[model samples]
Target: MQLQVLNSPFSQEQAELLNRILPTLTDQQKLWLSGYLAASQFSGAQAAAPAASQNAGQAVSKDVTIIYGSQSGNSKGLANKAAKTLEGNGYLVTLSSMSDYKPNNLKKVQNLLIVVSTHGEGDPPDNAMTFHEFLHSKRAPKLEGLQFSVLALGDSSYEFFCQTGKQFDDRLEELGGTRLYPRFDCDVDFDEPAAEWLEGVLSSLKDAQGAGAAEAAAAASTLQTIESEYSRTNPFKAEVLDNINLNGRGSNKETHHLELSLEGSGLTFEPGDSLGVYPENDPALVEQLLNELKWSKEDQVTVKQGDVRTLQEALQSYYEITTLTKPLLEKIAPLSTNEGLKELVAQGNGEKLKEYINGRDILDLVRDFGPWGDSAQEFVSILRKIPVRLYSIASSLAANPDEVHLTIGAVRYEANGRERKGVASTYVAERLEPGDHVSVFVQQNENFKLPKNPETPIIMVGPGTGVAPFRSFIQEREETGAEGKSWLFFGDQHFVTDFLYQTEMQKWLKNGALTKLDVAFSRDTEEKVYVQHRMLEQSKELYKWLEEGAVVYICGDEKHMAHDVHNTFIKIIAKEGGLSREKAEEYLAEMQQQKRYQRDVY
Candidate 1:
């Protein structure tokens, strides 16, 4: 229905503006607008009431503190967005990273909003470790008058999804703080849920402050039109310039060196940033799923409220089929009549459920639990959207303007009596070619960054694909002619077949952009040596470099390589500096707090 000036409170111009925007908005957008308008009306009504009718005890402070603990910058971005929204609504805002915030100041905060993402196996991100520990410690202060909320981001595929956020939310309430808004635990596709959480928080704040709080509806509407055209929500299609296999023939590993054109996209990135690629599922897997379901390829299904596509097209391009989550199994249980499937998802069967979910896909679920009663649309509704894959950029924007480079390792393995392939990795390695376009966006990482001072020496330890970002670092230093001395320790399986970017590292060392190069080829030696072994071998000089104010950067696998390398650093510090293990640990922690020790491990 069109907005008519005679029947509405809006002026002619306002009615025309509303008419233009209403038809273009999605269902979710319309619902949000309705809620916002209702909140505004309610606030206005409360303000018009007599001052004597107001409850003095319910009055709240206008000051707000937003703290974010981010690994790949998502939480930081959301925290900044929340701060802006609060500021637009006439609230005083103080925004900070969890690592930078002073713990003693917690008792002074009147309102607190935390945005944090859970890392591997439910651990807090590296930057959040200190604060997370402090808040849960015995010396933590009781926050009697504090009002707070939390926004937690995580992958549902993980067993302990959003664990860190949940911990903070419970801890705050235990310390006598009241919840201003309920905590939101978001899955991988968090954009919509996060928006809903922010809107709810704004409504609660407005209700507490009444109409005296400035209205942000007009400002938000204006800001939307000026947002960046390219983002996670709307990625730019970058044309591939080059695609080459970096590994020599006969190597066990396959790594692709890709160069993409960002000439007209206006996307800029630094050395430590990552590139997010949205990849399509394997057509073979999609066909197997279709055949098992006995569903027509041309059946129409709605991906979202307003977006519809063919079943085959949607399965191939939009939905995630490779991984299964506990929540997904629970959602699917009622749709099937299979007793075994239902029993496995029942309470007290968590171990069995976890075992079933590991290394299994949607195809396995359908085959195991036959005769699903739901329609194609209903089945698709329960599945999550395909998550983007992030790779460390391998080239500097300063050295190669309007071009971005990535080093992707193809992932293939045998599991459950069949071969499985990584969606994004294999897509780029086997299918992508020069002149093809891929949807991509740059992911800014504040937690991992090069030092602002060019004269400070840097020590880098990157094995396998972890060497990607260090390549960018060296290229950037070369382009800017920085005087800092840099050292690199890189490792792989075999020197002849698996040594990646060997010639490039040699070139940088020759030009003084890189001062030192150490390589460990595990398979080349009888006993198998890695980068950590090399660090231990050069313990004295490594400790000396640390004493010389050199920054250390590590990038690569988190579970094993990063963990082993971290312990190796402590051993080197203790043995060379003649300190105890405890003191060495403290020294490393201090380095982390000082931003001298940075990691981009996954």
Candidate 2:
């Protein structure tokens, strides 16, 4: 339907302009436009009436504050998106990181939106700690006039899925803040739910502030910027240039050093950024699952509303079949005739449910539950899409243009009398080969980045595959001729076979790109000496470096190594600086606020 001057109230040029843009607008855009036009007509009608009636429309607040607490940049990206949306609708938006936002200003905010991702074990992300503390503290003020909404990002696989967001939502309501829209808690697949939350929030805002507030120019500009060549939804397939095992013959571990060619993909990344890989499930596992279910491999299943693939193909590439979640168990329970499966997921069986889900997969569930009662299509319909695995980039773009590198450790373990393999890690280690293509996208992490001043010294503590980003960091410093003094504390099981990138580290040390190196081989020593022990050994010098303003970067196992390393820093600071443990903690927290201490642990 073309807009013409003969039928429409628009001039010939205006009609042509509308016709050109109407076809390009998305369904969401069209909805916004329609609401805006209706509101404008309503406002015009009121403007021509009595002046006394105009006060109510003019009293609506146009200010919105968006704060994000992000660990891997997802929340930050969404926060920025929400800011743009609000701005496009003629609202004055104030977007900030939770660490940077003033808690005292909470009382003044009319409309507030929080986009935060829960970190390890229900804890708030590093950047959100301060704000989270302040909000929950006794000093927190009442927010009677505040209207808020929260979009929480988390993985349902974790025991405390979106716990931090739930805390914020509850706390805000406790302080008398009204919900502009109910909080939305998202699992690993958050894009759709997040978009829905944003739309709902925008609608509520329009209802409250009047939809005539939209700025067409701003909306058009925002729509233009939304176009991207490649993203999480549309990953770029990059060819693998090299794939080699980093461990020697004597090692118990299998770590692959993978180099991918990003030529013509235009996917560039910095040292601190991560590469997200979409990997396929093992064919052997998929075959086993199909055989167990007594389903035909050629059976067609709908992966989504429009996408369809064979049962085998869907299990192999489209859905996540390895890990089992509580939600998955509940969804599949009704389809099963097994009394045991139903009882395990029954109410008041929370502890048992968590125990069962800990080390078991879909295959384990199917085997243990007994005879099933669902078709292949129905089974696959409830499965979540395979989440992309993110590995810290191991090469600098400046040093190796049109290429990206990753250090992936094969995760092979025995649990519940069955051998288990990591989805992406084992895929890279055992299946991927040179010249084979892998779909990838760059995930920017602003929280874990080098200092802007090249001369600032740095201390990096990375154990095992955690050393990946530090490799990129050192390479970047070397390539850019950075004058920063670098110290690296690396640990592994053995010195002989587990010294990953040993030659590269030696070359960088010789060239003075790395100022100091300390390695701890846990098994080689009489006692298990980890990175923390090494740091404690060099406490004096480490304290001196901290005093000299050296930025600290830690990447590795968050459950143990990162936690130990963090405490070790505090111990060193307390012992050397003659401060109490509490004071030392304050010092470390201050460093975090200054962006001198950053972590990229998982």
Candidate 3:
């Protein structure tokens, strides 16, 4: 008898049973199921069964659901890759951003894969908050029959790497869902590890499929479409059109208006998207390091799988020139036995290490270490990679399809009479001259987009350069002729010197494009008022707007401003709206679940 499995036609009750059973599956059982599912896809005539029996009973090949929770685009890329891989193997794949997925649809999942990245301090990515909360809530249904797996990505330097993935694994188990395989927690350099994990997952799932199911998969494989093009590792080189200091010369802080031409690249992005700028090391810093160490500039070095012409070339072309890590300190610590260095690496002194390394560079470390013999390869290997710097796109594709613009704050600070330049920021602001070409890529932000309903009012709270995307939003709204009322709350140090896009904002207000403008110049007043303070002062009106279904958007410093603004909204709901603390909290949470309260805070 030949049994064919095209896609498991799951009944609502069958899905609920699988969800209930998923968390109870043992490790060996998970491995068994994974292998069975994988083999079933290619089992061909060998594992054939009666067609009616196969449809009614056990079946391995099912529609694969790929859901991703991405803060920046890393998880999305991984999810996209996973979908393509399964599609290649003849599996029907449904891919959706977690924020867009209906939370109740988990009850309909027979085979589910979640790819999520943790944000600051173990928080789920902005888009995953709803799904994360729902899974742990009392309202979540028991899932005893579901088979699932999670691949979590995070930065190991953070205490809570892959935290959301862990949460999903635990919660799914608690709800009685079976794990298809052990969850994989990946760190900063996740590509190799992620690929290995993916291979394991696919190999296991391919083994348990019956012959007829296998033939069906083979048929679907030929119909799959996979993307082949430049990605983060290989970005398109874009020529810089202009790089002007937006901040005045006399002002303490330096910021720039960077315009890069993306003509003929076929790259497209929305307003809230970020541009990832790949930067090269500073030549001056490299020369200074060579001089400080008394190392020959002609010394050859190899790193990660490639060789460089010289030590200077290696430093400039590869390796991080700024931001010293604990590993670097550890390498130098033994040589120095300096009390400070020893104390930094000592037991129960994590905070001390953080304080010591916050702003210091490699030069400072070498100066204190008294110079020693370390190969260029060892030095660069121990050092972190030069990560791409992300800047919010300040221009809309609707306005400029052939170019992208950025408002970048040049990071310059003084310490020990030496100037420190932020590796990537300085590279973009000072080193990359106008007309120079630099590699670039787009990072989409689906959570931060304007509401689908154009008439939905938007209240934007972005101080300093956080106001960058709001400009794009206003432009987009103007171009689309949206009837939504736009209100902006922007703050900086001074009105005279710190107000960005002053003329444009004034024009927007004058032309009725912007319904309200609230400016908070923290330094102008002795009392020091910020955007949150302004929000609090206008609690009555703010509450009214919230009541009238205005979508609240906050983007800026996450440490203080975002938190403060969030708390202010909660207070306004409590005090101005006459709700209790818990009720006000519920109201805010409801708004987030409803997607009315959104943030793009960095």
Badly placed stretches (over 4 Å) of model 1 are 1-59, 211-226
What is the C-alpha lDDT profile of model 2 across 231-311, one tens digit per residue?
776799999999999999979999999999999987888889999899999989888888888778999988878898999
- TM-score, structure 1 vs. true: 0.90
| Per-model TM values vs. the true structure | 0.90, 0.89, 0.82
Residues 1-602, model 1: lDDT tens digits:
99999998999999999999999999999998887677656645554553335676444666899999999888987888788777655567999999999987999998999999999999999999999999999988999988999999999999999999999999999999999999999998887888778777776776666642235344333334334789887899999999999999999999999999998999999999999999999999999999988678899999988999999999999999999999999988998888998999999999999999999999888888863756888878889999999899999999999999999999999989889999999999988999999999999998778889999999999999999999999999999999998999999999999899999999998989999999999999889999999999899889999999999999999999999999999999999989999999999999999999999988
The C-alpha lDDT values of all candidates are 0.90, 0.89, 0.79
Q: Candidate 3 on 1-602: residue-level lDDT in tens? A: 22223345776667667767777889899998888677656643443553235655776655788899988778998898888777656567899987788878878787789999998889999889878888899999988878788999987556566889999989999998888767999876676667666765665565545334444445434322343344565688999999977675566667788899989878888877888888887888888888886667887777556555677877786667666666567775665546767777888987777676777777777776555445655555566666677788888888777999988887788875688887888887778898799999887777778888999999999998889888888888877888999999999888777788888899989887789999999988989999989888888999989888999888888878998888889899999878998999999988986878878776
**Highest TM-score model number:** 1
Where in model 3 is the C-alpha error above 4 Å?
1-58, 100-110, 137-147, 170-182, 210-228, 292-295, 304-309, 326-352, 365-374, 414-418
In terms of lDDT, the poorest run of 10 residues in model 3 is 219-228
Model 2 alpha-carbon drift over 4 Å, by segment: 1-58, 212-227, 371-373
By lDDT, is 2 or 3 better? 2
Each candidate's clash count = 0, 0, 40
Q: How well does candidate 3 score on lDDT at residue 519?
A: 93
Which candidate should be chosen as best, given lDDT against the real structure?
1
Q: Which residue pairs of candidate 1 clash?
A: none
